[model samples]
Target: MKVSVQGVRGSIPTSGSQTTQFGGNTSCVTLMEDGRMIILDGGSGLQKVTLPDPEVKRVDILLTHFHLDHIQGLGFFSPLFDPDKEIHIWGPSSITHNLHSRLNRFLSPPLFPVLMRDLPCEIVLHDVSNSSFEIGPFTITSQFVIHPGATVGFRIKGKSAVFAYVPDHEPALGPKGLIFDKKWISGFELMEEADLLLHDGQFTTEQYGKKIGWGHSSMEDAIQLAEYVGVKRLLLTHHDPAHSDTKLNEILDALKSKHTGQLDFDLAREGMEIELG
Candidate 1:
């Protein structure tokens, strides 16, 4: 499987010299295998994704939640305007609303100039919770996780590799920290023993303390979870918009020094690509 990081920032997009290194777009990633494309999230970075082959008319997008930072790029995604494309979007649903109507709330007049119904593409919306399904060459598992609202984490398995994505998680919300029991830990099933894990590490320990329950993880929390899950490689993503490149570098340097030789880890940067098997 081939994975591409289009955006890494969390909460909101940022700009300027300080943010250029890591990029400023909110959460979006792409996984491609067997000429099939699976998009995760529809953040501002979604506008950057392009269909490499015009002949590949089908595309799937899996959204973790309806947060603004996660779905802000849907209106700008070019595929929505392409009549020849078949777009399938999967997301969690609330008791009062389904995925289509919820997404329409954002794609409607006041929030967006073009309504979702006005899009030219053949769009299909699927409501997902704890479920397993297939798309092209991939088997995907979606499970509810600890976050604000109906958020989910995904485990995607291709022919030769497994990739886990949980960019807006807060698994260590309780005073006890990450629960040691795998059965009780949020998103553990999605992350366990994956070849690569892209996870939330949006705050520092101190910052996390002040923003508890804001539905993000500290770098320490992310590292601990990755270590516990036994993932081969870990890429901490969903960078805080306020954290400049210099600040992120400093944090990475310190983490490397503190946890050297324990695990393979790095910050996920926009435009970064990884091939796994």
Candidate 2:
């Protein structure tokens, strides 16, 4: 399996010298396994994704949540303008609305020039209520997470590896704050020795103190989860827009100082491509 970090920013986009190293575009990732292309989220970075082969016509996009930063790129996705393309979108449906209705509300009318119904390509929206499903060569299992709106974390299993993605997640905040003893995450099974875990480490310990319950996790929370699961590699993502490249480096430095040689982790950066076995 091959994974690429297309964007790493959280909430809003950023720019200037402070963001050049990591990137400014919001949540989006491209995953490839056995000649199949799968997109995780449709943030502004989705616009940067290109078809390596023009002959490949079908694409699958798995959305973790429908926040503006997550879905902002759908309107500008180039394939949507191609009549011959086939796009399938999957996400959790809110208690009040279905997936199609929620997406159409933003992708239509005064907000955007082209209505979703008028798109040239055939777009399918699947509302995920059950826990597991299959898409081509991958088997996906999702579960609701701790977020304000309906949100889910996904565990994607290819032929040889498993990848877990949690773009906007809050660590266990319930009264029982035990790490390993409690199943705080929705898709907990995905954490078991995952080849790569792309998780939300959007805030630092100090920032997290003030922003508790904001539907985001701190670096400490990410580290704890990775340590508990014993994942081969942990890649922290969903960077806060306010955190400059230097600040991010400081965070990395702090982690290095604490764990010594015990753990392997890294910060996910834009345009970073990696292969997983």
Candidate 3:
């Protein structure tokens, strides 16, 4: 399996010399091989990614949520303009509305001149639950997480390995944190021994103390979760925009020193690539 980090930043994008190395796009990742492509999110990073497979005429975008940062790139995705491409979007439906209405709430009207109907591609939307689904060689499963609305995490089991995306989460994974029903948090068990787990590590230990219900995780929290879940590799992503490259490096170094063994990790940078057998 081949995974590429098209964008890694969180909240808003960043720039300037201090932020150059880590990149500034929100959240987009792609898995590609031969004649197929699977996109994880459409954050600003998605706008910059050129699909690895030129022969990919069919695309499936597995969205974790519909937060602006997560869906912003959908409007600019070049393939949406291609009338011949078959694009299917799968995501959690809000309690008040289905997937299409929820997306159109942001994607249409005065907010944007073009509507989903205006798009030339054969677009389809699937509102998903905590169930397993399939797209080509990938068996996709989703779970609910503690966020404001219907936030979810995804696990994609490909032929060679399992890759899970936890772009936003607020579980208390440490000793002092409050315990919630295991079933309420969908992606934990699905991530067990995962080949690669790209999870939300958007706050520092200190910052997490004050932002408990904000629906993001600290590096320490993530490390503990990764260790407990037996993940082989953890890529800490969904970086906070205010964190400069230097600050992120400091956090990365600290995390590496504090956690070691079967579970390994690195900060996810835009354009980084990993291969799983």
Candidate 4:
């Protein structure tokens, strides 16, 4: 399986010189192999996606939640306007609203110039919960996680590799902080023993102290979870919009200096690609 990072920033788009190296676009990632494409999230980085070959007739996008930073680029994704393409979107289901209704709140007039119903492509929306499904050659599991609203984390299994994504998790919200027992941890099943895990590392420990329930995790917390889950490699994503390239590097460097474990981990950067087997 091949994974590509299109956006790493969290909360809002922060395109500027200060964030050039790590990128300022919000959460989006792509997995491509054997002519199949699977997109995770639809943030401002959705605009950065290059369409797959014409032979690939369908593409599926799995969204974590309805947050603006996660779905803001749906209207700008060029392929959505292509009449010949077929697009499938899967998102966390709500008791009061279906997937289409929730998405319409953003793709309708006033919020967006075009309405969801007006898109030229054949768009299909699927409501997901604690379920498993398949798209092309990949098997996916989507489950609710500890985040604001109806957010979910995804576990994707290819022929030879596994990848887990949880870009807005706050599993350490309680006083105990990230229970060591896997059975009690949020999103633990999605990440356990995966080849690569991309997770939220949006705040520093100091910042997290002030925003306990903001649906984001500190870098330390992210690493701790990844280590506990025994993932082979960890990519810390969802960078705070306020963290500049220099500041990000400084924080990572400090963390690395104190880290003595053999775990392979690093901050996720836009355009970075990893081929897992």
Candidate 5:
């Protein structure tokens, strides 16, 4: 199996010498298993990828939520309009509307020239119910996350390895203004012992405090969760738009020093690929 990081920036895309290394596009990733593809999130990063040819067959896209940065690439994804191709989308249901309707809102005329109903490819939307299900050779499971609108973290277990993706989650803060115990621990459990975990690390401890309940995690919080889960490798994702590559390196250096040999962690970079046995 192979996992590729197409984009990692959070909120919006940024451009500057400072962000050149890790990249400036929003969240999007591609996971390939047994000749099939599974796409996670659809941020600006999706625009960076070249979709497979129409004759190649359909793929699955599992979404965390419908935040603007997370779905901005939906209309730009080339394969969606191919007559011979199909795209299956799975995501948490919204309180006020179904997933299909929400997606339609984005693709309708005025918002975009092409309406979702007019797309040539078949688009199937499924409202995930927080349970485990099988998709080809992968076993997938999801859990609710603490975001403004409901969000979910996904764990995909293939024949030989496990991969977890959790973006835009706030490590629960208690009434006293500290990390909530249960929510923090539960997030770790969702990533426990995975071969690779791609997680949100969108703020510093100070910034996270100011944005409590805004649904994002700090670098320190991500490291602690990595330790708690005992994951072999943790890739810090959903980088803040204002963070320069140099600043990110500084944060990583501090994490490396603090965690030492307890956990393996690194910042997620666009174009990076990891292969599992």
Candidate 6:
């Protein structure tokens, strides 16, 4: 399987000398297994890729949520409106409506010039409820993450490799006076032993403290979870908009020093590609 990081920025896109190294595009990734394509998220980074014509083959898109930073590129994903291809979209249903309706609103006219009904390609929406299922030659498992809206972490297993993605999440917050819930711990367990674990590392410890309930985790929490889960390689993702490239590098260095010879890890960079056997 081949995994490509089309975009890795978090919260919003950025530009300037500060963001050059880490990049400023929002979250989006493409995974190719054999000849099939699977897209994760449709952040601003989707603008980086050329969408195939509807007459071409269809692809699968799995979304974590409908947050603006996460789904901002849906309208620009040209294939969605093409009549030739089929788009299979899977996502957790929101509290008020099913996954299909939520996505429909985004593609409807007014907000979007094109309505989903006019799209040439067939769009199939699936509301994911079970934790596991199989799609094509891959086995996929998911878990709910700590986020304001409904969000999910995905574990995809191909013939010989496994990839886990949890782009927006908060670390398990221990009991603090009256607040105590351990659900976040189970979310991390879903990524255990993954060949590649792409996690949310949107803040430093200090920043995270001020942003509690914002549904983001600190780099420290990400490192600890990677170590605990025995992931072969951890890719820090969902970078804070305020974090400059140099600052991000410094954080990487700090983490390397602590992990030493224990684990292989790196920051997720836009256009970075990984091939797993």
Q: Which portions of model 5 show Cα errors greater than 4 Å? A: 51-54, 176-184
Instruction: Please identify which of the two predictions, 3 or 4, would achieve the higher lDDT against the true structure.
Output: 4
- Clashes within 3 Å, all models in order: 0, 0, 0, 0, 0, 5
Candidate 1, 142-258: lDDT as tens digits? 999999999999999999999999999999998888888898789988999999999999999999999999999999889999999999999999999999999999999998888
Comparison by lDDT, 1 against 6, better one: 1
The residue-by-residue lDDT of candidate 4 on 100-145, one tens digit each, is 9999999998999998988999998899999899998999999999
lDDT of 5 by residue, 1-277 (tens): 7899988999998867889899998999988887777889999898767654446777688888888888888888988878877789998876789998988888888788898999998998888757688888888888877777878888889889999899777755556442535454645556888999999899988888788877888888877777667789989999999899999999888777767565778999999999975
Which of 3 and 6 is the better model by lDDT? 3
What overall lDDT, based on C-alpha atoms, would model 2 receive against the true structure? Answer: 0.86
Candidate 5: the clashing residue pairs are: none
lDDT of each: 0.94, 0.86, 0.83, 0.94, 0.83, 0.81
lDDT head-to-head 1 vs 2, winner: 1
All candidates: TM-score: 0.98, 0.96, 0.93, 0.99, 0.93, 0.90
Check candidate 2 and list the clashing pairs.
none
Model 2 agreement with the true structure over 1-277: per-residue lDDT tens digits: 8899998999988878999999999999998887888999999999889876777889899998889899999898899899999999998977798899889887988878888999999998888854799988899988887777899888889999899998888865665542575455544676678899999999987898788889888888887887787788889999999999999999989977887445689999999998987
169 Cα displacement, candidate 2 (Å): 0.6
Q: Which pairs clash inside model 6?
A: 54-84, 54-85, 82-121, 83-120, 83-121
Report the CA-based lDDT of candidate 5 relative to the real structure.
0.83
Q: Estimate the Cα RMSD of every predicted model relative to the unseen true structure.
A: 0.9, 1.5, 2.1, 0.7, 2.0, 2.9
Between candidates 4 and 5, name the one with more favorable TM-score: 4
